[model samples]
Target chain A: MASYLPTPDLSHLKSADYHNVYEPAEDSFLLLDALELEAPFLNDQLQPRWCLEVGAGSGIVSTFLAGQVLGSRAVDFGTCFVVTDLNPRALPVTQATWARNGLALHRLHCIQTDFIRGWRPAAQGFDVLVFNPPYVVTSPEEVGSQPRGRGGIDGRQVIDQFLPIVPTILSDRGVFYLVLIEQNRPQEIISIMRDQYGLLGSIVAQRKAGIEYLYIVKFSRDTSTT
Target chain B: MRLLTHNMLQCHVKSCNDPALNFPLQFQEVELEQIEAEENEALLLNLVGKIDWPALVQTTSELGITGLPPTKPDVVKNDPALMKRLHEILLETNVAQGKMVCRGCGHSYPIKDGIPNMLLAEHEI
Candidate 1:
């Protein structure tokens, strides 16, 4: 299923484009794998009203989900795509990537902000959310100064800040897909979502790519328990 | 940014917060473009139930749009005209460039080439 739909094209992006924005790699492709697996379920049943990717870098991941998972009949489903990224450079890079893929930009709205900070609900809350955060451990002081792919202090500096906001924004049937490394403590992270936020989480897919052992974890409100 | 999106955004600057009127951020010297899209009644119907009509009305007014009803109405499944108007205003009308100012604390966010930059100063957040 991974290669059935080709990984999106990045040939058009100039070398200068990769300076600040994250160049798509194993973590990004790992996320695409998870979304590919969920594509059938997302289209067949969820029919989400709003889908978002927070801290979207290069826009490839959200673009993949839009074309692959949300189905091309998005307008009829009334699904809106909101892509947020703090780096101003990444947003434009995202648009270029989407345009190259032959997807319409009219349906997707890109907002430059810190991880969904000022966004309120539109119609219903977001039903499908994805984040491939900056997960490389670095000093906490260096967190915001860097561009794309540097997570401070156990690689959870950025990821931890986002966890609490998930249960607040996700719809009743909502699901959030997040990518992490082994050092990010997947077990503890899942337990925290379940015990603290009341959102059930499990690792949906995992792979050892290069030197990084990547994991894609999904969280949703457990109807059986809640 | 589209008006539907502007409706969802407000002043996130912690000092000038919500549970207060910081939203429908007043538009100033804006540029708008109408990007045509197909009207989807099913999507509209699913979305209408959750829209905050007053906020949307305020946002449209900021853009000098006065066509929407003062208040949201009951489901008009058969009313194609109303559906088109809603679809047009909410999804089709795009804000290409502008400035959104907070009413609470007078903070401003800029919109350039169609995307709204909602970043605030460190002190604000």
Candidate 2:
């Protein structure tokens, strides 16, 4: 007799039926993991500052910051997260994230934006910038209408576009936090930021998920006058 | 338009008369918007092989979508970190107000109002 294995059940892991892109159960765990890493960098003293989160998937990271990290804000942190995405279908989940967590609506502002074309912010608007972009490094024919993860050919396309204009969009003293894979040519992205875009930073955290390595990075702008 | 579109674009330079030259249409003017979606780890698993990594990175970087995954993850199953990054890349970034230039032919297609004008001249087609 030959040994046989059953096909994995993938539908259960697909997008939730009610919400567009959020999986409440799965993301809740991921959010906790992100907070575990981000908390040290986002010290409690940094509260009451305006923050912008470019990619607020299911509002997990922001909700974590508001609830677990920020604790209760006396002055409300003046933090306003700008959650953006290309798919108009996913907005409701981000809105519901705060609602589910009992966070105030005033603390969040959602935007349907295209990260590729770039973004414009009010002068000196954000104190912190957080992003978790798609860096799958795929081909054009592959990313067909799928939401949430579409990195082009070399996997650095999104990063290249972003580093150049980060200075322009970020507040002068703003801190940047992000996650990327350690396996691929991440040096390519860092080089663009340091050599080309002028952002300076080192990997602040690292974790292994099975065979893949994940890196948490944080950087600050130079104190020189622009 | 997204970098996915950019990868397919090519310039309609003087000597290149191929129809494929009209690819990777350029953007003229566009209205950008961002929306967040739920995390679909399964799709990330499926799409891992579907994407044009270099083009996606190039277009997003050129368009200013930073903070993406460094490369396509090998084992994306049950990995929270990888899935989280997948959520950000797929749902959060937008491509408004720009055009993709063809690397081959150098033709320009303008994106206006969030829609790409992928039309081509008579000769190019």
Q: Best by lDDT, which number? A: 1
Runs in model 1 with CA error above 4 Å?
A121-124, B18-20
Which tens-of-lDDT digit does each residue in B45-124 have in candidate 2? 43444455654565566556675556755666657775676556544444556665654576665654333444455566
lDDT of 1 by residue, B1-125 (tens): 77877877888777765645787688888998999876677666765665678888877876688678887777556777878888888778888898888888888889998889998888888
Residue by residue across A1-226, what tens digits does model 1's lDDT show? 3556677777888777878888888888888989888877788888887898987787788778777666566766867788999888888888888889877776678999988878864443788999988898889887872356678999999899999888889999999999999999999999999999898898989999888899999998988874
lDDT of 1: 0.82
Off by over 4 Å in 2: A1-19, A22-35, A38-41, A116-121, A143-145, A224-226, B1-125
lDDT against the true structure, each candidate: 0.82, 0.52
Q: Is the docking of candidate 1 incorrect, acceptable, medium or high quality?
A: medium
Question: Model 2: per-residue lDDT, tens digit, A39-94?
Answer: 65565544435566665556666666665665455124434455565555544566
Cα RMSD for candidates in order: 1.9, 17.4
In candidate 1, the residue pairs with backbone N, CA or C atoms under 3 Å apart (3 or more residues apart, or in different chains) clash, namely none
Worst 10 residues of 2 chain B by lDDT: B1-10
Output the worst ten-in-a-row residue range by lDDT, candidate 1 chain B.
B42-51
